[model samples]
Target: MKTIHLIVHGHIQGVGFRYFAQTTAQSKKVTGWVKNQEDGTVEAVAQGTENQLQSFVHTLRSGNRYARVEEIKVSEADQDQTYAGFKIIR
Candidate 1:
């Protein structure tokens, strides 16, 4: 398993971006936490198989019809984060 840091940009705030991400991560059995950034972006750190992480990123791009994600910055994280389930951090 691996940890990936994702920064999603564009019309993502106040449009259920965090919820969608959390739900998607859970459905994929991924461990992570998502939060709204101060710069109006959505941020998440997902830990799972590489394939699962890719799928999660794909969902962030296409699964959200109501939320238009313009760009996503993804990178490998230094360590694995233990999370029982995905959540939207306030």
Candidate 2:
């Protein structure tokens, strides 16, 4: 198992980025949360097998047409065993 945090930049606000990310995470059996940042970036955490995490990142890199994710910053994260499922944080 692995955990990763990602800050996605460029045209990531509105346009259902959080919803898309949540859907992708659920389908991939990844657990964590997604939310908007104050600086117009999208942030997310994914916890699961390394393969699933990689796939999730790939999907984020090439988001839905409505979104244009120009860059993503990823880092290791502490385990969050309490997270039950993927969601859009308030």
Candidate 3:
């Protein structure tokens, strides 16, 4: 399994980006938690197989109808971290 920490930039906040990430991650069977950052970005940590993570990233790029994702900064995260489900952190 692989874990990645990503920061999504652009028109993400106030646009249901966290819920979008949560739904997409769950659909891809990825375990993660997504939240809105104070800097107007969306941050998430996802754990899954390589394919699953890739697909999840792709979906995140597309975003919801209201979100215009400009960029996503991704990096390898602690592989030891695990989550039971995808969540939208308040």
Question: Looking at model 1, which ten-residue stretch has the lowest summed lDDT?
Answer: 78-87
* Local lDDT at 55 for model 3: 99
* Ordering by TM-score: 3, 2, 1
Better of 1 and 2 by TM-score: 2
The digit string of per-residue lDDT tens for model 3 on 1-90 reads 999999999999998889889889889999989998899998999999999999999999999999999999999998776799998889
* Residue 74 accuracy (lDDT) in model 1: 97
lDDT of 2 by residue, 48-83 (tens): 999999999999899888999899999999994657
Backbone clashes in model 3, listed as residue pairs: none
The superposed Cα distance between candidate 1 and the true structure at residue 68, in angstroms, equals 0.7
lDDT of 1 by residue, 2-90 (tens): 89998898998888878889889888888889999899988899999989998889888874667988899999897735777787899
TM-score of each: 0.93, 0.95, 0.97
TM-score of 1: 0.93
Candidate 1: segments with Cα more than 4 A from true spot: none
Q: After superposition, which runs of candidate 2 have C-alpha atoms over 4 Å from their true positions?
A: none
Which residue pairs overlap in candidate 2's backbone? none
Clashes of each: 0, 0, 0
Model 3: per-residue Cα lDDT at residue 11 = 98
The candidate maximizing TM-score is: 3
